[model samples]
Target: MTSQTTEATPDGGQLRVSTLELFFDLVFVFTITQLTHVFVHHPGWDAVAQIALMFGVIWWMYSGYAWLTNEVAPTSSGRRGLLTLGMFGFFVLALAIPDAFHGSGVAFGLGFVLVTCVHTALFASSGGSSAITAIKHIAPFNVLSAGLVLVGGFLHGWPQYLCWALALACQIGSPYLIDTSGFEVRPRHFAERHGLVIIVAIGESIVSIGVGLTGRDLTVGLVANVAVGLALAYVLWWAYFGIDDERGEHALSAVPPRERSRPALFAYGYSLYPMLIGVTLAAAGIQMSIAHGNERASLAAATALSAGVALYFVGQWAFRLTLRLPRPWTRLVAAAVVCLTIPIGVAWVAWAQLALLVAIAYAAVIIDDVITLRTGHHSSYV
Candidate 1:
């Protein structure tokens, strides 16, 4: 199950992302877009939970394939074909997101099962007996989780949600429940894959602004709001990429082989979930505010915008912690500022409040940059 073959050599030759991998990532762009639509149309606690649950399922399944590719290069014709099939599976899953909690649940469930089964088969077909043994430990939970998802498709109300939640739990918890010590992750590939997905999530936010303005005639006010939304998105991007993009990969590469899986799971697998969630919520908020421009913002819309910013900071804190890097004090303070401003900004127009939120984020980035300069700790990655 352990893969000495996947580790980097002493010279630190970085593994490049392959063409097939980029093609595969296109499907996730649509998946994240669809998830944002779920929140755009349905704005309530129930919808939030459903979106979060479904997002977790999609993220988990996608990350599994990412880890698989880290070990097995997708250069062969057969491997490319398998990955192409996975793309179709994910496309169907994305299409079914609108009705995942309703009539098309069966489609979503079947899609989930299809993708998971393909991944398991790929691992089973790997070269080593250890790979096969790893499959033995991993496949049963996948099968059971798939079954639960399928069964959940047939139910309704909270009963259906309960079933889906349990399925997600089983799928997410399985790696920890079983011994995956024999498994290996290529640090660069793993980090790059996750980072690419984060970019996809941010792209979804930008798409939301367009979708929100679908048929409306562009006005000065609307154009101004769109510009502000773009600024917020840019700040989020800088917040992540401005720091060492490869810090996590470098940190993971430094870990002793036997101990890498835990940090990989906790940091990339778990901590990144909230980051994705934050982007989705922000998309929802941006869409809502744009659609309601020049009007009083609802509590829900304000909360989504503020909470989304806070969650991003919180997620960044966890991710930086995992890399054993310095704490992101600016992000933490920014998150607190957003939360505290929410109640007081309730009376402000939605667009104005959004502008203020952007200001807060920019301030944090400026402060962090100043601190890095003072300490001479600033660094960049290509």
Candidate 2:
């Protein structure tokens, strides 16, 4: 936190994501894995709500650190050590995801509190008066929210959820409550950090496919399902990175300094909620479908797989809107088509349903590519 502002500022040219930062991200790989596990085992609406709340807290911790790193260079050994310590907190939080609703809620709550405390300390020491001011406003809310999470851990059922919800409300609303004008965001670093996290989430989806298939007897049907799963994951990757990735960075970079926070909040901060949720849901779907390959899908499984892809498309559209870029109709149509397939998918075998989901995503990417080629523009709506 110690005002390494001079070293951290992008005035030294475009700031790049550091190796330590990438190292820190490895913790979230486990976090997402646990989330997919939770969803696959407990796909009920109540479970989904709990997962979403947990994800909100986890996302805040991750994104908060990203923002912190963007402002403060972890160049010194001391700073790097602090980040590593924070990583341990996240790792512990990931471990608590399974029992977060029941057995080990206290551990989960305390882990989150620890991470947020580190974030507040970093912000408190990093910038000048503005950073200190932000710390003053945000730190108290952080403590209060952490206390709520801890208190929620001791409660059960609806009351527990209520406390957790109140805690998340404070974290989510804090950005607007505090004055961000004093802080500086290096657009390149911020954009790249978020994009990399998305990539990690995608990797988790890929891992889910493998994890689901582990130790199963390999057959032509299972093999086919695996291929389709990989294709779906690839299409998700291509859909986002093909057009939006670099453009997103440029969009953030182009925003006026004084006004940059709004777009950053919209494009990266807020939009990422759906993106991460979609990716997690998609991973859960892949696990369910792959595990039940050759069997007919349940409504829940079909909807999870289909709705996951649809949600991803919706998220991409929102991201483009945030950037003030044109939304591709192909993606919107793809979302609709995927949703329509829930019924079709329910009647079809799991592998076939997966194949259909893959087709929808692949078709969208292909159509977007064709439109880009024909019009010399990345988005058809442009």
Candidate 3:
């Protein structure tokens, strides 16, 4: 069955998201590459501060545009045009990020601040007081970051580093300034949007695995490694989209706008942390495997994949609890995710054994779900 609802806005009510909105997701393909590059290059303690700060800023900008699109789009062409421009800004920003904290800090910071201007235009064109509020909250940080970028232009060494650090702080804190109270989110629409992005992340993982395996000797070990990587991706999808998503939609839909926003932020925005982190880790693992399975699996790769699997279950449990869903089957899914991590852990003893074990464990989860449905035990949790 299909479901639809009209969101009542200060502006005329309109359909939530349309073909254009879905198509805009292509912009993030560039974004995903930028983020993946950051982790790949540095993947260390020093990088963590910058990575976390940058990730949050990227989410804030993307979510801000998305929220505006949910409200102002279809009703206004100007809004759509501004969003298209904003996507361009994002493209520029992605290109400039590699040198943002270093010598090219000016170009990187300017690219990002320009994005803020696009966001400001988008929200202002939407014609609500919150537009002004969002602008006020975000612009200072943008300006501040811009100033640091200017200073870093001439400075070197620690002087440049200090400015970037200050800029990072401002970027990370911008969302809280905008505040989530009273922002409207149509639940199914929001869930579906983020769900599509998750699929993109997973699809990228598959592509990364394929890229890793290509033009190499087709050995049994390489074949098995591919199978295991694909299995892990499937399990991650099943755990989130399969069960938790519907529950989250129902829960968010039931709440008053004020009460609903935090969970929405946590469930949707924060959930990407695990999903993207997992994809990055999986990519690293594939790279390691392709390098002739020579070195021991790094702690970082294992942690990334494991954390991704663990977060899916955590997200599931959180989804159920938020909605007061008490289904036994949901609990079983959570248990199965915990068990799935064991194979990833087994990599320490033997990498090939780890791959095979991961496949079995993931298959076990799918088989259990199938059996549950077969016996008439499948129950709606929301």
Best by lDDT: 2
User: How many clashes in candidate 3?
Assistant: 0
Taking every candidate in turn, the Cα RMSD to the unseen true structure, in Å, is 3.9, 3.6, 5.0
lDDT of 1 by residue, 1-382 (tens): 1232334333222265666777788998888888877877888788789888887877887887877776667645786688788889899889999889979899988998899888887777752465567768988988888888889888889988998899889978898788876667668777877888888888888998998899999989889999999998988888887764556778889998668877888788887888888888888888887877688777777788788888888888788787786655656778888776566346868887888889988888777767766877665632
- What does the lDDT read for residue 225 in candidate 1? 90
Candidate 3 stretches greater than 4 Å from native: 1-16, 41-43, 47-49, 74-76, 129-179, 290-295, 311-382
Which model, 2 or 3, shows the larger TM-score? 2
- What ranking of all candidate models by TM-score puts the best one first? 2, 1, 3
Candidate 3 lDDT by residue in tens digits, 5-103:
334455542345566666667776666666555655766545444555455556656765656655465445766677777777777767766655656
TM-score top scorer: 2
Q: What TM-score does model 3 achieve against the real structure? A: 0.76
Q: Of 1 and 3, which scores higher on lDDT?
A: 1
Tens digits of per-residue lDDT for model 2, 1-382? 1121324554322277877788888998899999888888988677678888998888877897887887777867777788888999999889999889988888988898889888888778764566567667777888888889888888889998999999999888988888766556678788878988888999988999888888898888788788888888888888888778877878878888777877787778788888888888889888877878778877777887888888888888888888876555666788888887777657767887788778877887777777666876653222
lDDT score for residue 310 of model 1: 86
Error of 3 at 184 (Å): 1.7
